[model samples]
Target chain A: MESNRRKFLKVAGISALGIAGAKPVLNAFASEQEEEAQHADVEIRKNEKALTARQWAMVIDTRKLQSEEDLKPIIEACHKTHNVPDVMDTENAEYDEDNQRHVIKWIWEEEYKHAFPTKSTEFLDDRLKNLPFLVLCNHCENPPCVRVCPTKATFKREDGIVLMDFHRCIGCRFCMAACPYGSRSFNFRDPREFIKDEDRNPEFPTRMKGVVEKCNFCAERLAVGKQPACVEASNGAIAFGDLYDPESEVRQLLKSNYTIRRKQGLGTGPAIYYIV
Target chain B: MLELTVKGSKKYFGWMALVLGVIGIGFCVYVWQLISGLQITGMSRDVSWGFYIAQLTFLVGVAASAVMLVIPHYLHNYKAFGRITILGEFLAIASVTMCLLFVIVDLGQPMRLFNVILHPTPGSVLFWDMVVLNGYLFLNLIIGWNVLEAERNQVPPPGWVKPLIYLSVPWAVSIHTVTAFLYCGLPGRGYWLTAILAPRFLSSAFAAGPSLLVLLCLLIRKISKFDPGKEQIQSLAKIITYAIILNVFFFFCELFVVFYSQIPEHMDHFKYLFTGLHGHGVLVPWMWASLGLMIFSIIMLVIPSVRKNETTLAIACIAVFAGTWIDKGMGMISGGFVPNPLHHVNEYVPTVPELVITIGVYGIGVLILTALFKMAISIKEEVAA
Candidate 1:
């Protein structure tokens, strides 16, 4: 056993030397275009016609979502298209004093006061005071969840969308702690077991037990030149566009309205803005 | 040398058998958990981590406590610690083994654990924790085994081991620090975001680890012909006294900052822990009990007359151990999750199977410690004869 360990260490040491030897040679042959592209502030789109930017962002118009009924279609569309599991049985499941349960959710509604606990005040208008605000992953430019993942299971794409690679997740839940937004969910059991057969989207793959998952902002949809399921269903309530593009609807909306973000004081640079 | 464990007193064999029995049961329960998933545990979407992670956090301190002995014996040239230093290292080995086990059992995908190493993320604190913890375990194993071998042979330890021994000291500090970073560096959890978390962890670990060691030393003296010596025990008590005092002071410093600021994000967690926040206070009793024990232990330890008596000292050390165990293991992790991202207080209670698994892991740690100490003590007895 000792000799085997020694042999492994020797091989590892030689590999380290090989990598160190190859690094400078690899760097020396870098193309001028590639170097200039690396320095470019804007992302060079694969297809110039596609709505691509260095950072993709979302702007939610909570005013348009006047009632709980207004949110159902958007949420249902996202959940159905993404094959998100419906494990929560709120009526039947035993709940503690905190009303917590073993559940999976990619997006949901929360009271404005609770959703913006640090920012909201008690003396707001009665309609706004009792408003049910939509909440989901902020897709922060500096996502803490991505930073804390041991397996690099969750990572931020160059377009600023946080992506979850379900296969790589070890289900350690470190990202759960790191994400202040509480956007991530772990599949405690086989999610497929909880999902209804008719509701399941055969087009999308379901996750297995023991992996953390969260909203990917429908990066797959964006790849295929389709709007996010929620955005398509919101009927102008939600605007999905590039934050880096001056002509984008989201950028225009942000310019015209005062928008707030969840825990912006932490300097995570959250991409999801709320037009409260 | 491996056979040394086989020949033991009937009581020793009985104890080993009992621990093995519990481990057998625990293994069965762990298999159930693996098949059914973490759904059986009380962990919810809000409180993602529960009892297992808490135990992992606490045992990391116990593992890092070997440095308490290593620092004095090697750096300060304290000769009295030479006899008990191996005991400390062996304890660390056992503690780390349990830490690793707790991590594995807590994972949703225990099979995918190597994905951590396979990916080798420098960005993640969990990755660093894996690195430092595995590194510390091996360091202690190599140092403890070689040093004991040299002692048994009645020769000086090999020259290479001296550097490794020195390396283990800072390496011990790194383990707890990385563990603290796992919580403190998170953006959302106001409770663990304090700058003092790493130092607080180290101080509390210094107190808790040495306290456990001193208790173990007393136990060894009672059970075996070898005595770790009164001087070594007393020195360890002194270390615990100063460390526990500093640990308590750091806790108050944290309290002051949170209360004075009056920020709900920061203050809400303390409110939940010390007092019920928004009518949820499941952990209040445990938190207060921890505080009471810590105060009582510090009072007893500070008074020389009380501390000098071995019986009183043992009781005080037990208090310190239990107090810090509840604080670091239960309150710290759970409190961070309460008043979760949505400003709701979620409570976590370990299920029966979860408790059994936890006890089983502790049994494994004890079994490992017993075997290592059995080997060491037999060698010491032979050397003395």
Candidate 2:
């Protein structure tokens, strides 16, 4: 009986060791299976209701820009959403050039001559020449700003959206110089100080001084299945959708209208289109 | 070696005191900038870069000019440059330090500078710039210190230093080339977007740097019994003369392309620099003065008698130094941004605090230079004795 008990004990000890070692082996196999089953990036950024796009593009219909007055609400929406500061220290100083040194903008109006300097002629149509053109970040496919940022603070999303991480930016202004559109702005002073309490958008992150910022194409709102603030406020003047999708409204608008992009010859592949 | 710096005459201490005072004032102003943001400076949304970046750009050329001496002495076996090669390396050390300081001050988030290293992006020219500039600085410091130490001890620099000295020749060229890439690679800035920018930068660098060396050698003669050699001075003058001629030739090449093509994008920036654009060109007179001075120096330096004579050479070197400072240092940066991307003519002029802050950086550079040069000069004197 003692011999039998010794054999049983040895068997039990070996079995215990086998099971203990098998636990890690099983876990390793399971992890490998899990990785094979799904992409690593799939685990991140999950929201069932979120809007999806292959590539974001913007269509600005200058035909719909009836007057300079039509630009106000769209500008207001973008500025309010982004917390872009008025450096003039006045609430109604949008066009003021007195403090051009500290001008910070997300979206604003431009004359035809300034917006398309190469295209504008001395004897252009009076109405076309007089109309205010909407301008913002081109969010180029070959973004020079993204190319120049040393810190990778400015980056392009897979969906062809150029965005900035304010926290990571060293504010060296290399990106500002790289941007061919004059779309980027540097905060010469504390941006928070320039913003009013009521105008602050709680949903959006307010920026600090000493960072570069520009139009983000309302990526935040898109994550919640809403269009860009400017697009919503534009009263059908602006269309935002996936350019890569042929069936998308932006692609439809692009096909239907005769459109042009700024500095197209420079080959940055600007995403902001002007429907002339 | 450090003892050489400590034991100096009363004038040396007075000079140290003055430099310290400037640094103290600059520190206070910098603290203000840190708190108040860059709003204290003259940089604008349109002209995003201003005086600080310009200074750094100019100094990169100065730092790279050490290669001029290195190539002559090491490769061509031109023995006259052997004496002053250490001086070139030491000047490079000082210039690179100033370059770094200027970069730090220009940063909106100076505290977060290490992010460039932490999140290294190989595609960015700026990442390459930081790498090359810092590498050049390290190489110069190591090589300069060891060589001078060997000179004092009356022994050859260790065998390891030879490879590094050879490495530094190409490394010097890389620093300025990468710096030029910072400007030329940008699409919109017509003034900086030329393939010739790098070559032009090098030519101007060779001119400004060797001329400054000439001035320093002359000053050294006044202070000590040692002369860097008259032939050496004349050789440097020839280098300066050729460099200035090439610099002018490069500028004219750019001008021809801009005007001959009738490209508004390119022509407008030059117009703003040379003449008043939209009746508001603060830099017009300055640009003309720069051109005139460069021409005068070329004339003076090309003549054998003028360059050979200590007095005329000193004057010509001063002219080249000042002229190049205005052209490459002052105009190159802000000129690119005038008639900004949207074709707005927003000019940039440095504020008083900005100018004072700039002067302070120069003071620190000079102070470092004085100390290093003193150490070098002492060793030379001891060796001569």
Candidate 3:
């Protein structure tokens, strides 16, 4: 890492000197550097089955999700795969005034009343009234988290995943404050302490204390040519695909069924949609 | 100039020792927080920011209040303000110092704070806040020290400082406005989404900052050979009165929009803060106390006879300072977060260590203010002789 930074500095300095000598040479050098970065990314993702997308999105069909029981495995699969800390289960976690306040979840269930607060009403259909909605990062088309992050630690990927570069995060929680969905969680304590060794995913990295974290739409799984853990776990209750692709599952679901996005008035363009 | 600070009365040295002692305790507690992470604070995932950020937000206003003196003295050539303007600048230096410390302590990764600079995120409001705050600090340090040093040397202040003094007028407003942008621009947070947040922040800042200056001037009068002058105090009292009135007026306007429209997304936060949303009303009493104090102070300052009287004016100043602290510093942050984006009420109150560390930061600020005031008073005394 240190040598890479030194090399970058050297390249930047040479470019600075090159600018004084020839503009054409500077432009060529910049393009060459960009090609090298793309080459490195290709080398890292050697997995041929890697799922590619123009814009990733999800569809949660309430008709498929018959009961609260149907939601458990979907949540469990994502949490287990991502090494999300079981916040309330920790012994002596009583340090918090309300443990749920400190609870961290990448994807979890929120009641319809709370999930679609702007849209919820008291006299809704009894089934809709008590229904649970799956909530996660909207992976917004215009992400406020990305906009407000001073360190650019929480950022939107080209494929529409709002991912965290944990190593670079300053944990200022500005992103948390900026997130309108309540999707982000700050690690108030060492998250590693809460995850059991048996439940911990060796393939996924656990977050340190103090940094903010949230659902990355399983970008890691996608890079390895696999569907997100929740998509596989939800028994078709959840559909995931590229939103820009008309032939994709999410696009098909949206076209056939009526769906609602949370806080649509805010114009964040949430990729996650609820099929009411 | 340095010697002037070191040479002080028994009372001054004793006061300095007391400040140092508080800082010592605070530093040790802060170390504990550094080791333990933010779990030591009342903040949670829901209320991501708490006491530390609140204090930073409040002190920015205090730091910006130096402009109240600058505008009148430099722009209008108000001779009465000439005596007290240096004190205002020095107070800014101390307040900005505390503001910086609060940001440091609030960070989950303090070591990586420079990432804001290293990454150079011109897009982030927080990045701009950092730029404006540090710039304001250097501006005051340079302008205050140079102007004072020039006075001590019995020569004219360098011409370069004149432009910077003029630059500081708008720069001061920028610091608070940029700080307001950190909140007002966020997507879902209803309490902070108002367009008037920046103006409200400014009005409260102008009121609270000048009120603090009034108290500091009063303290200087009681202890020092050089008085900050009654005319200057009366002039500052007038500034506070007008600012506080404007601040309270802006708040009522916000209340009207929130309640009259009955938009639960917006009104729920106000209900949570002032009237307790869902059996969680920890901040309710404190919010009322703040409103009560502000109204009482406004009434006192509004009466000309009372505003002219130093004792009553001093009481009003205290009320303004306390009221604004509770309203802006405490209520604004917690209320914005309490009804978390999911509309859940997870109340936050500063933990013991958090409050102590806060007191420690204030102690350090007081020590800085004390030193700066002593040196300024000493220089003024020399000039008087």
Candidate 4:
């Protein structure tokens, strides 16, 4: 009886060890079965959604912007859509010679003298004297501003758009100092006071005071497989397409035309190209 | 450790510095800028840094000027500095206090400054600047206080204090070098992006900082009865002469590279500084005056006869300090902003609030210097007694 009891205890101990080791194996088998089911489910759903990938690029034909008139609507639309109020303290604006703060213009009226210091338009007529072109953020592949931003607030998205995470910024203004293009702006005060409730765009986060914010090329729209608001509102002036695709409008335009960036000599290799 | 001794017999000039009460009141008006923000300053997005940074840059050099005396007395065992080294340390304390004050007054958000410490960003150079400035301030304060305390007690400082004094020699150079890095490390600004900028800053500091020290010594002599001596003044002048030559040499190197290469980005900043570009020639005269004064001061120091004369030496020292102050202040800060890559000239001129706040901070520095020197000189007199 004693021998039988001892044998029974040993048998029970070995059984417990076997069961403990087998439980994880059983879980692994069940998880694999579940994963296979999920994979099949995902494959069935993939056909309906049509998840096509896109890499966005913008090409501006300066020939189209032969006059300042052509660029005004595009600039105005962006300013309106973004709800950037007419700068009240224009006298303190960085670009304003009279120091009057007006609209924070995303697109600037650039000219031969303003864009190219080396280029001389001495022989040009009065009409051609300062042939204005629209200039905006180049959204470069290796952006100097993004590289220098301490907060990692400014980052490049997979779809070739540089975005600003306003929430993360401490408003050190280091990025503003770094950006050669002067594309970034610091919300010196509460930006919401200047913007109305009807004008507030939910996709673009309204910036807080003491934070640096800038053009994100409307990444939220791109995620929904739509073009940037600026490009769409540009009335066919800004051609948007994939730069990687040879047959795309932007790639074809780039290949066919002699194009320029605001400061090509800066070696920023801006993704946005301007055709003169 | 500081005691105020204003005997009725001792004609205290601190009463005179205090008698300049109108200036102090004007300084108070200037300090009302804390409520107003940096909008009152001549600064903008393009010219993000201006006079405040400029003054801070110059004062850092002035603070580093203590190394001149420290190197001689501690390193070379020049006992001639023993009677005067304390004054240099005290001057350093005053100058660094001004440097920090100018920085705070210039800040767009002074209240948020401690955030740099709490949420420290390793990538930001400004973070390192705070560390260096505060470290240098405390290091000098501790060294100066302990040494003076030991001297008051008529005993050598504890052996451990010697290591700290020795540590301050290179630490002083680091202060100015870090200030140079603040300018030089910016990528797009071609004016300051030079490997030689740090060396130029040191040379200019040695030239301008020590020259200011000499002038301060003379001012102390005029106000009080402390004579740092003719030999000590001459020795400082010699150091200034060498440093001025080095500074001039560095300036020429910058000119040669910019003019010779004719790289538009680099050359344009020089043109903007020296000859004026894009209808902004206001800084041209200032830059030339700085260069001309630096040259004249160098000549006066190099010539043995002029160096011997107290008036000539004082004039030269004054000229160098004034010249370097303008060069480091206006030319360096504005040159980077003008003819920006966008071919824009964002002119920077300090506003009334900016000037007022700057004056207030400077007044505070002068006040601190006046108070500390009064105490130091009295203690020295008592020790000599």
Candidate 5:
């Protein structure tokens, strides 16, 4: 990358000087450079499919989950351990009261409405309106969050989990806005305020104000062959397995059950599936 | 007559602008935000964009408003607009400059903005917004400068310049329409999902933007001895009246649709905007203020006796401009995100750094506007000679 950049700078400088001296020479050089850039893109594409890794995904069985009370503790433990700050008390509280303000650290989504107008529907009773599902970053085939981020702070890993580099983030929170699932959270205030001084999850870095922070599917833990904290804490109700490995536990579960994503209509093609 | 160029208009304006500059400087206290992250602003995860974007929306309207004069004078040959089109263009340049600055300030890493061009995402609305705004800015620069140069040189502008001038009439409309598209194109935000949003934005901008220009022209008349003519002023007031009525009518049409559909997803945004859904009521007063100002301004502008009366027209302009700014600028952006998709409220308030950055940008715009207007006045003085 450095050598290419250096070569580009040298080429640009030489071309600029050439343009000042001879316009025809500069035009020839520019066209040649453009052709080379196009060829490089084609070369990258030819080699892309050969690259492989353990494509990790999750399967949550919502039918096994009884109530918010049954799920809250496991959700809170991972959240508190991860230092995911609660966003309930901010100015947006006027729209909804505190505690009702949404904060996520690998948790369940009780009610989700699809983005497409035709797909959006309500039940006769408020309780029966929407099915509860586990919500987290989809690690999508084509992630909008990764695409919209100007800094490239949010990116997808080879393992299929979308990772966010917290330190490099300028904190414009465009990722939070782009995510259709409402899976991302912005650090409205320093997470350090809520974090216990001695206790911190080294696997999940506490975020600063202004930047977006979301579930990375515990990329740090995955590097060491450990499962995600939420998957481990779900009392085996959640299954974590390699999506590429047809023999993996998640694949077996998928084959046995009617699996669904939180919002399949959005076409995110989420890696995480749920057993209805 | 020579003294007019030598002496600046209202020696007090420099000081007044400077005071605004000083107050703007006070916004620096929030610079920790850029270092610490966006936590300094009263924004949370849910309400991702806040006051900065709202201000951008309003200012964009103000920026695009330059067309009202340019179109009438160049297209229809309204000589009444002959003297003041430069002022509108100058204001457009100033406001658009600020609009770009606001986008920068809103970025988490302002430095990484280059990556936008380096790795452009053609699919995203943001990428398109960048293209249109920068394109509009360059277009305005050429149009404004060429016209000014023509007036200065005492020549009918070059024939090639005519196409560019004609292109600007639609291009002016495109800038604000694209801005509206920035919101409307978002799939999830029910408030912006309506197809009417872009037209509504244009109508409100036409009303507020020209109203502001009319006020500025009156001020130029009072202090700078630059009378832009009463007929031109009254003509713009008539346009403002119609635009405001259209804007208000479109808003009601939206309200009617939201109620008629009875869709929870669609209704929630309107509920949050006007009635304060789930108890978020901060936007209620601002909405009322906007509605009240629009109605009052329309009444004042509709009556010829009042619209013709310079003082009444000035007040009407101020009311309409401020009202439209509140509705388009503040209420719309916040209302879209409040009670966010997850039913979460993340209220956005401008922090100190955000405010300072905002003020600094506004100051820079004002300085640019002042210089351009000063140059325009001198050129006019030279031409009349």
Candidate 6:
């Protein structure tokens, strides 16, 4: 009976040690499964509600932006609506007389060669070569700007729009360095000085001097059920939709066209797609 | 301790007055900067960071370099560096103070500086840099003060102080590594987006920091009764030689990968730095000057006779310090911005106000170093007597 008790005690001790060692392993596997479930939930919800998904993206039809004139309306709508400053008169004496240092832009136009530098080739058609492309913040899926921002001034919304809280920006401009798209603009001086009082949009607040500003994808308009000013002005030339939704308009446009993104090879997963 | 600085010669008082005058002018400019905004400076939207950030980068290396002395004296138990480690620690204190000031001045809204601490985001490298920099500053302050106080009292430092001294060894490395990450982790900057940036920063810091220390030691020998010893300086020179060699080798490794691969993004900044990309090569002359200084210094330092001579060593140290300053300070920060995201070249030049502010900041560093070194040297002289 004593011998039997000793054997039983040894078995119980070994079992306890085994269970103690396995607990952490089990907990790790359980947490991983929970994470997988959370991912699955996102996928399912994205399919169920296209517009309400957590990722927002845009597609620009470059074929439609055929001329400098074609690009003006969208650029004007964004700048005017956002109360972006016009710094044409501000000059840096060090630079050449023609070179202006104070020009600030949120969304602007660039030639195809500069816009799509990596994809440009000599074999490309002359017409496409001459065509100007409307460019703005890619609102990257993994934004370097957000990663580098010391103040949480610029942050990604749950729906994946990279939004800027102008009040919070300390204007360090680290975000500008981190941005691969050159999409951000800093106020070199008081933006209020350059912005005409008459031209100022009463709805949108003008930025103070020393803060960084950029395209926010019109989160205000999106919150109110209106499309972005550029999208509305483009008249179907630009598609604004949920990127995670397989059936969303952006996804449909991306599927139907041979679309390219600026510096996509850098693995930033830029949301702004260009349909050539 | 407070009386220690007051007990200096007429020359010392005149130097303090000069530094104070610069600080006074800088304060006025800073007030103007605060009122008018960053427009008073030369920075634009394209080239966002300029002289201020560059100085901050260089000075962080200067701050981290206290480790060279710290490691030898504390970790390796090298006794010759005993008197000199305090000099390095004091230099660190001054450099870090200037680094913090540079960041404050560079901020678009200096008032909102607390936002970084108030709303901490661990994901941001800037947040990490803030944490590490402040931590390092405090670490140096605590260790430097306690160690010097103990020496003044002719007693061993408290038991807790030892661990903190050792902690500073790795903490020193982290300060520069985190600073490098501020640039390296940026996805779009081809020049900064390298795995080797942290290592390169460390190698450069090791060289630049020790060189400055050696210079400071020589200056101290001339100005005061405290001698940092020839042996310590020689050992430091050797350290600088090895570190500079590694730094140059790492840079070449970077060049080889970028040029051999023939990647446009990788080659763009190098081409701009070396051979003016797209007809805009403002930095080419400066880059070549920096390279020449570094190579010449390396040649001088490699030879035993040149390394041993006090005058030649000082010249070599100056060369290394200047070369590394330009390389890490101006070139790295500015080069990363050139061939910007849109593949456009926009050159940066600091305006008068910017340069004045930079000088003022440096003046502040020098003043702090003078005061701290005054107390240290006074205590050391008393102990020796």
Model 2: residue B92 alpha-carbon error in angstroms: 0.3
Clash-forming residue pairs, model 6? A54-A159
TM-score of chain A of each: 0.79, 0.82, 0.83, 0.71, 0.70, 0.77
lDDT of 2 by residue, B259-378 (tens): 999999999999999997998799999999999999999999888888889899999999988999999778999999999888888889999888888988999999999999999998
Clashes of 2: 0
Sequence-dependent TM-score of model 2: 0.93
Please list the Cα RMSD from the true structure of every candidate, rounded to 1 decimal place.
5.7, 11.2, 7.0, 13.7, 7.9, 11.3
TM-score of each: 0.92, 0.93, 0.93, 0.81, 0.80, 0.90
Indicate the docking level reached by candidate 6.
medium
Q: Write the per-residue lDDT of candidate 1 for residues B125-146, one digit (tens) a residue.
A: 8999999999999999999988
Model 4, B57-96: lDDT tens digits are 8888888988999999999999898877888887888888
- Tell me what TM-score chain B of candidate 3 gets against the true chain B: 0.99
| Model 1 chain A worst lDDT window (10 residues) | A90-99
List the global CA lDDT of all models.
0.89, 0.91, 0.91, 0.74, 0.74, 0.88
In angstroms and one decimal each, the interface RMSD of every candidate reads 0.8, 0.6, 0.8, 3.4, 4.1, 1.0
Candidate 1 residue pairs in clash (backbone atoms < 3 Å): none
DockQ values, each candidate: 0.69, 0.62, 0.64, 0.14, 0.25, 0.55
- Pairs clashing within candidate 2: none
Runs off by more than 4 Å, candidate 6: A1-53, A89-99
Candidate 4 residue pairs in backbone clash: A87-A102, A89-A101, A90-A99, A90-A100, A90-A101, A91-A99, A91-A100, B30-B356
Worst 10 residues of 1 chain B by lDDT: B341-350
TM-score of chain B of 4: 0.95
Model 4 has an lDDT value of: 0.74
Report the poorest 10 consecutive residues by lDDT, candidate 2 chain A.
Answer: A90-99
